[model samples]
Target chain A: MKPAIDVVRLARHPKRPTSRDFIEYLVRDFVELHGDRRFADDPAIIGGIGFFDSIPVTILGHQKGRNVKENIRRHFGMAHPEGYRKALRLMKQAERFGRPVITLIDTPGAYPGIGAEERGQAEAIATNLYEMSGLRVPIVALVTGEGGSGGALGIGVADRVYMLANAIYSVISPEGCASILWKDAGKAPAAAEALRLRAVDLKELGVIDGIVAEPGEGAHEHPGETMSHVRKAIAAALQELLVLDAETLVQRRYDKFRRLGAFTLDDGFSELI
Target chain B: MLTRLFVQCPQCQTTHFISFFKSADYVCSRCGHHSRLDPPRWIKQLCNRGTFRSLFANLKSLDPLGFPQYREKLDVAERTASGWEAVVTGTAEIGDMPVALAVMDPGFIMASMGSVVGEKIARLLEYAADRGLPVVMVICSGGARMQEGILSLMQMAKTAAAVRRLHGKRQPLITVLTDPTTGGVTASFAMLGDVSIAETGALIGFAGPRVIQQTIGQKLPPGFQTAEFLLEKGMLDIVVPRKNLRATLVTILKIHRTRPYPVRRRGDE
Candidate 1:
């Protein structure tokens, strides 16, 4: 197994294939959608209607810029309230049209900014989780790079969730965790290990459905092959998800998230206390 | 002896007799700053006398990730909060109206949503759904528990799905956003209420104020992320003060109550 920090480094590689790259390669005739309608358009998250392998689908993801200038514009792929609301709007549209929704997760969490909070960031993400729970459509989410906290889960409450081989998903970033726990940001490697954020770890923990294999080294090395794998994984998931009735699809989606937790019932402990 | 008898309000530094403060439900009489309350006090204040019966009290958190110091922290939380978990859930009656209530105690690891907290809330929602009872939750939290890692994050989805099920049954979910509701808790069930009411001076948002400040590299405007701020942004229905909370809740519950309808048998048209 790779050291968790190294996976984090690979996940954040400058040359890695971004959400835009995947959409451009796998989604044909993709028409980009913009704006939350309630607020200004957030460039951090790009969502639209597109065709995946001739199947009409709604594709959306957190888009990290390829260069410094664009990165600043995208807020380093950290979404604001508008980004989540836009995703929710597009998701509702997908449901109305019976189109399968494919979300790519890559963010450092929602943008922690004054404007974001003033516009109701929590409500935006909360609405997505509540609405997506009952969305009567096949929904698939792939953690293409970094899956950060509620921002990732905002678009991640899917029927099937997948992760790239080198990707990392965590409650908090390693640096954040380290600073809080160890009181030192430099202890990120140890924090990363403790968080168990790698794709394999998440698979074992049943937090994700499957892992898409990256070709050689990582996705940044072989973007074409890597995207092909992501395409295949998504297609496979949709193949299995499409046959179910709307009721079952929604119920199963709810159950999938409903079953995620690790705890023990200590009746004796309660009594002792 | 003076410190024990007189408690100083953290917000205003007004010292008052502990007895008087307790009688006031921990709200500072002089400055009206609402201090955080434990589950026991919350139930006593919100629920009708002797009407609260605790539920899901046996679910305890496990160090699933075996993160450093987590077990110690849980032990400390259990001791400090005097509870099994961050939330205390149960069936209760408010002004004679039966309901399900869940109160998150911020004293317990800042009431962070771990597996136990999530599972308890989810089960409470499910239990309420089964009995066709409305749920009233008092929410206060820092966010997802970091020690639990991805499992803690998953709790947000779990609780939200449970809330969805309760909504599907046409059962009402009224959430009382108290002091310091942020992060995963804010982004999940806390904000999913059919009627969201925040207490005055409560901090409610996805990201904490300090985080927003650090990200934007500027001082936040006065009263940012407060319950009043949320109300102005159209995110909350109303903001009530601590003293009026119980009465307000009772009024809301009464208004939501439907008239009794006759049940139809299988053969009856």
Candidate 2:
């Protein structure tokens, strides 16, 4: 076995692209929006109105840097409260204008600094969860990579949630999970198997709606081709969701989350075996 | 010739018989420390007599990862279990106001947030939102369950998402943080309440102080994560004594009932 692209291996894989890389691929002539208005602009999340095949859509996602300096600037794709606030502001704007929303998720999590907490990091994530559930617009979340914890979920609730073939989405990181469970971070690979965080596995668990195929090994190997695959998936999902009325869309979204996870825990667990 | 069982206060170096602590309702007699209360007794203490009706009692956790020691540990919890499976979710009356309540019990697996705990809390919140009832949650956790791996971790987001609906409606969500509220639970819904209440002497922070100390290699200041410090820094609204928690909750509920929606009672306003 070539050691399948589960979330754990995906975390270690050399070729995974960040959200910004994917945004460059998918968004065309995108006008960027900034600031939660109440707070200063956060660099970790990039949002604005963008055109996809002449169609206007509000595009938002976590952005990370390729180099050390950039990572420091981007916080390794982790968002602060302002980042979430900005996205919410834009999302509200999108709802008003009757535009579809396409959010790309790629973050280890929300920023956990003392300052971030003091400024209401958890509240921001919580607000998104509450507000996004009722947004009167079509929402499609694309987990490009590293769908970490509450940060990813900050922008993750949607009518349809899709994951890139190599992307992973879970409540916690594999390393964190490993350390807590095994008392050793070295057993992360083993923890990854237990997490069932890969797209296909999550799809089996019914956590994600579908998986967008990546090009050649993974998305980083062939970025352009990968974008094409993502572009097609987003187009199809949005087309379907856009037709539904606002009330129907919101109700469907709530019911979708409510029905998530197998009843009795074992029903969800039995699938893993 | 009576047999006496003594419990030691973890904070203070004082020891007392089980009866002494029980009569004191699990508070340390010497230092006024509130020992972690079990789920059933605490639930009874908070809710009106026979008014607490538990729901989602059948939802137990699954060992998805099949971690060697987890299932057996769960079985041990089950064998001597109270009415809840880590958390008690139900509708109860506090001072005669009907509210949907969920209390995390440290007695069961340290009141950890797992898939079931998250699900129960989320469902309860959504239920409260749908019915326009208030939500009262008592949070006491060691964070996420490690045995369930990522499934355990996802509870943070899942539960937070549920709390969002209630918060969005501006419904009263009274959260009482008991001893040692840390990790993902504290980082998510535990702190999202309209009024964040912490018991005195409770250790509340995102990361444990030891981790922070070791990571930064600094001798940290004392009382960094205690309720008094957090309250002084505006992280918590109130730090009520355990004896006053029930009365305080009742009064808060009364205020919630009488206050107008979208609470515009700022001093300047």
Candidate 3:
């Protein structure tokens, strides 16, 4: 029933565990922050100060609620511009206090509502990308669940990006892809297979740093074990990154991303020369 | 046999000659409906004669995800559009001031950014960094290509990182948003410009208006995601008519070339 062997089913479990599970099980004491300071607070993303193994860390991630009421409250984990702005503000705060920033990736995407756009959602995400790239602190991003597009990448670019074994990351969800390409949302199962959004595929393609293992059926069935695995993986990465100074850390991170996709030109096209 | 073909404008419902419509930059004479431009024609309109140097044209995409019919779609895209990816980036001169330019055309599979487009942008900006040239990117995209999956999504981060590196090096980035710049493209580098510009009637947003309407289950306001709407909302510096796009870039590049950007941060060296 758990479908652990089927990556799509494992990843797409409607009741798959959410980020609250991670913060609760992993962080010793977590205090959540609210608002982007410039706008109203967004419940879709949860951000604040937390201690990871006695080390102060800024924790941020998309928050999908457990029930229908919670989902409506959290906007089904679709972050708005304020959510990103809040995350950026927290990341900046973390930098000032020399705290490592931890982001848990899980979002279908940024909220696509009309108001979100008018309020500068693009500017917010772009600012995060520009600022986070140069932010002088250790940043770690883990794809704890559905890491979807710019909404996920809003906080996803980090010193290291990891994915839980059962997590899925994609530009567009299978349903959306199916609707757009084949004009049929019923073909989502086929679309999911074609997406190759499982952790294993992304890891092989050099899209993520590593894959954190899960204990049983996946995060939904074994949230505790999942949290522990993620905590250990993030701690190990932080230990490795904390050694270097700001300049070196930023440079190394940039270099790491810069080397992700390298395409070469074969000699056959030399006729133009 | 076929001497003439008339196409009706979607906005105005007016018929126009095919040759006349194309020569007019695909604009409707009656209603001023600005149609999308293809990449090669876009380059011709923006750059000096014989000055465009397309880099990384060989960085074509593969069917990494083994998505059904993706390879065949790529073949079709390559044949219909140019042999390049969604973005064509290179060093070119806007008049005398040499600028690094990236022009995305909706013709090339909706100018969607994938791994190749991302790599091209990152490398192009890096190239600009070495030369200390200004950047003006004409954006017309349907966002990230869904066929490439997460790899396409990663391009959002990768391209943003490139823009960051360019910014760290203190280069001027002027983003020109054209029709249909939405989704991942809008959420990343499309709005990161130091001075952002949108062409008149351009549709720019994180999501398509239809998607929003469906999500919220409501009727959208008229002219919701248009350039005029975005400008009123303070998202754009200004909206220029397509006719003035080249001149506007020239003016901006000239001023930037003359004055240069002041260093704004510590550790920028």
lDDT values, one for every candidate: 0.91, 0.79, 0.83
Residue ranges of candidate 1 with Cα displaced over 4 Å: A268-273, B1-3, B259-269
DockQ score of each predicted structure, in the order shown: 0.66, 0.37, 0.58
Give a tens-digit lDDT track for model 3, residues A1-273: 222227656665667877777888768789988999998899999988988998999998999988889999999899988999999999999998999999998887889887897898888888888788888999999988888778888898799999989888888877888898799998887777778788887888788889999887677888777777888899899999888899999988788676665344544432100
Q: Comparing 1 and 3 by DockQ, which wins?
A: 1
Determine which window of 10 residues in candidate 3 chain A has minimal summed lDDT.
Answer: A264-273
Greater-TM-score candidate between 1 and 2: 1
Better of 2 and 3 by DockQ: 3
Provide i-RMS per model in Å: 2.3, 3.6, 2.9
Name the TM-score of candidate 2.
0.89
TM-score of chain A of each: 0.97, 0.93, 0.93
Runs off by more than 4 Å, candidate 2: A1-15, A263-273, B1-4, B64-68, B126-132, B153-158, B164-171, B207-221, B258-269
User: What is candidate 1's CA lDDT for residue B138?
Assistant: 98
Of 2 and 3, which scores higher on TM-score?
3
Interface RMSD of 1: 2.3
Error of 2 at B46 (Å): 1.9
The parts of candidate 3 lying over 4 Å away from their true place are A1-16, A262-273, B1-10, B17-23, B260-265
Q: How well is each residue in A95-205 modelled by candidate 1, as lDDT tens digits?
A: 889999999999989999988888888888988998888898999999999998999999999999999999999999999999998889999999999999999999999
